[model samples]
Target: MQQIIAAAIQFNVQQGDVEANLSHVRDALARVADRGAQLAVLPELWSTGFAYRTLTELAQRTDAVVAELQELSVRHNLVIVGSQPEPAGDNRVFNTIHVIDRGRIAATYRKLHLFSLLGEDTAFKGGERWCLAETSLGKIGVIICYDLRFPELSRRLALEGADLICVPAQWPKPRQEHWRTLLRARAIENQLPVVAANACGLIGKLDFFGMSMVIDHCGEVLADAGERPGEVLATLDRQAMTAWRAQIPCFADRRPDLY
Candidate 1:
């Protein structure tokens, strides 16, 4: 069979504007469906645009945003992956990624590595769980912005049979090189495609450089976006992934006992 097509939407999020952000997210989902995409990915903390300055004020509305994504996924017959502030009850909050399929939450991954530089630790609770979801395409792994810098997380997912690792990020501009290099490295070492959706423009004082992209198993840039808001689409071929793994044999040659 042919590969599944996925879309990463590079959104220009307005800081602390939940309504506008959610509206853009819905528009992004519609655009993805119009392009015949099976899976649509949105950037990290999209519900409120990584507004750490006022995250607590916006935390209560996350559930409503998730409900909207669920409704959109069901209406469009597409898999939707997005992030928002999570109210963890008992007065704790987390930055969470939700994977919605067929109108239900298939998996939710809380951001394990919080960006301390962004003062994330002060505003949100970190997670102890690593999650992956199975879909018609294959096993899919998810992580938020800072999580991409940790190879161990992506490696663990790859070892667990994740063919595609989707990242929803609000990565900033100045360090664009790090974003590109890390994403390519993840795809190369894991032998799985990496789909990253990043936000662009300015969110408060932080300027996000939206280089949203799709990388193949061999670390090739399949589809890439610029520093502006847009959408990138790429066909993730299962057969190609199989062929790459067969040629490299990295997964089979692993010696986990030594580590």
Candidate 2:
């Protein structure tokens, strides 16, 4: 199996400032490429911070952001996974994630589990299903922020043959502990690698805690970024992942019908 270098970009995003955010993202992508990363994961709602209050206005600009990301992906020869607020066809806005591979949009995942506690439901529409996208490395599954709390989603993706899961989040400070624990638990239980990118700094009433990290199948943290703006890079080896799965056989041993 081949190994691919990956980078998770953790930064402070400005709310409703698309141009400034894209500039920061461009710089991050360049830095990651210089470090030899072929894949980059960015924080949730990156273009607009976690500004749900202004989602209605910002949602209309997703196409522009996607265009910028597509160009960056091609230029860097990288696969990019990131989230933004987007308007669905029905004119309702969804918390959407996009997977860009070699300049093309590979897949778009709408966040299934919206955080109602934070008034997310009032501004963003909920998604109904999950998405797994194909890349040069292999099949990759993506979930935005709160979706990490649902182990069933991760399990389903792993059973469907995902080698790694990417989570783009704006996880807050008070629940940073939950963020770390849940991410590790998902990786360990599914026996697959996980890459998470989270934002740092304050946005209105929410203060994001960026402990972005990459965890291997055995529940070990391969690379971790502290509660500050930065980036972490790691190489994901498919051979090692395959070996671990063969040794554990958790998927093969599961009795889905009984549960």
Candidate 3:
């Protein structure tokens, strides 16, 4: 991983309003570019926020949405990470994250773990595999909202030589502490930098408290977005991550056989 400037875009997501949502992302991305961000993370299902009733229709527009993202990535010279509803066979949509690295579609990851409490399993198709997008910037390991609760997925990414992790989450209230702690824990344990983007404000019946964070390998909070619709910027130093890893040596001493 090279020393790079990164950002997280946290905003109030109006469910089912693709135009409005995309507009917000575009505006935020331009500001992010102005701030010299090389990589930016967007919230999960940002394009169309789980409008289950018209999900299939929304999923049909994913290609166009991705094309726009690719263009924006090129315009900003940034690696953008975000999720949208993807059209799956059998009328089900998969929550898929697209990693656009400066005009190229670096990787597309489907959400492995569905949030059953919110009936996500019933509305969407679960992914069978994970993704690690290798870009010019770095190997970006992506984790959706619910996936944060599962350490094994992230551990696999770390074992696979991911330099950093990007989490695009729509995690809401009552579990704010879980969101913050798990993000830092992932970085500390894996000895990798983390960029997490979360949504804020009310969306339908649910109220989201955005606490998007950029964390270093030693679990230090580099930048916090707070509980509002905004963007947070941070500069990640790869040398710092390497130094911390050498100091702790957690990955080198992992007892895989014993576990």
Candidate 4:
């Protein structure tokens, strides 16, 4: 069985505090590493904790976050996925996820779908492209919080040969059901595993519910954090997924001609 231990680091993000938030994430990564996780995922806007007022102020240069992640990846010997506020070169800021594998950046995906209710469209620039990165485990696709609502994005990544999709989010309590349902739906419909890392506690006026989870291709919940700040670990079986895909033959049965 080709297996890898994946972890979702669910934590309470401190608003407007990059240094403290990074420190917290570092600790979380260390904890997951100690527990034998080959891949550790963090929540969206983790560095700044969804601070809308000072998003630009808290935005870090991509190089800075990447450098820190590189060091952490090498130290822990694990892959890391997370997002931060990034400058877009024209005074625009983007919510971007950087995939670091064994001390090197494998890929970066900026959030394509921004939440209008949270004023994300007004505050941050939406990404224009989708990305998938090949890793030691398998081909992995990345998307931010609101991007999970769009099945088209995940479907595109699945068609591009992504075996797993990682979602880092700061989803609030009011929409917790949406988060859980979407995660499972994406996994079942795409016939691939989905790892979601979400923030907990309060960020400004909004309260975040931390039900971070790892769902397999059949929509089974391998692990869940359950409304608390902690790490949820699960082992992914690539061989089993491959066999299941062969048996179901969903990908091979796709007919794009009519669509």
Q: Which residue ranges in model 2 land beyond 4 Å of their true spot?
A: 89-91
In candidate 1, stretches whose alpha carbon ends up further than 4 angstroms from where it belongs are 90-92
- Best-matching candidate per TM-score: 3
Per-residue lDDT for 2-118 in model 3, tens only?
698999999999899999999999999999999999999999999988788999899999999999999999999999999999989888999999999999999999999999999
TM-score of each: 0.96, 0.97, 0.99, 0.97
Of the two candidates 1 and 2, the one with more favorable lDDT, higher being better, is 2
Tens-place lDDT digits, model 1, residues 170-200: 9997999999999999999998889999999
Over 1-259, each residue of candidate 2 has an lDDT whose tens digit, in order, gives 3787888999988988988888999999999999999889999999987665667788888898899899988999999999998886554588888899988889999999978887777667898988999987689999999899888899889888898999999998898889989999999999888999999988777788899998888889999999888899988888888898899998889888999
User: Which predicted model would earn the best lDDT?
Assistant: 3
Ranking of models by lDDT = 3, 4, 2, 1
Give the per-residue lDDT digits (tens) of candidate 4, residues 119-214: 788888999999998887778999998899999999999999997999999999888899999999999889999999999998888899999999
The local distance difference test score of model 1 is 0.86
**What do the candidate models score in CA lDDT, each in turn?**
0.86, 0.88, 0.93, 0.89
Better of 1 and 4 by TM-score: 4
Which whole-number lDDT from 0 to 100 does residue 253 have in model 2? Answer: 92
Residue pairs in clash, model 4: none
Better of 3 and 4 by TM-score: 3
Root-mean-square deviation (CA) per prediction:
1.3, 1.2, 0.8, 1.3
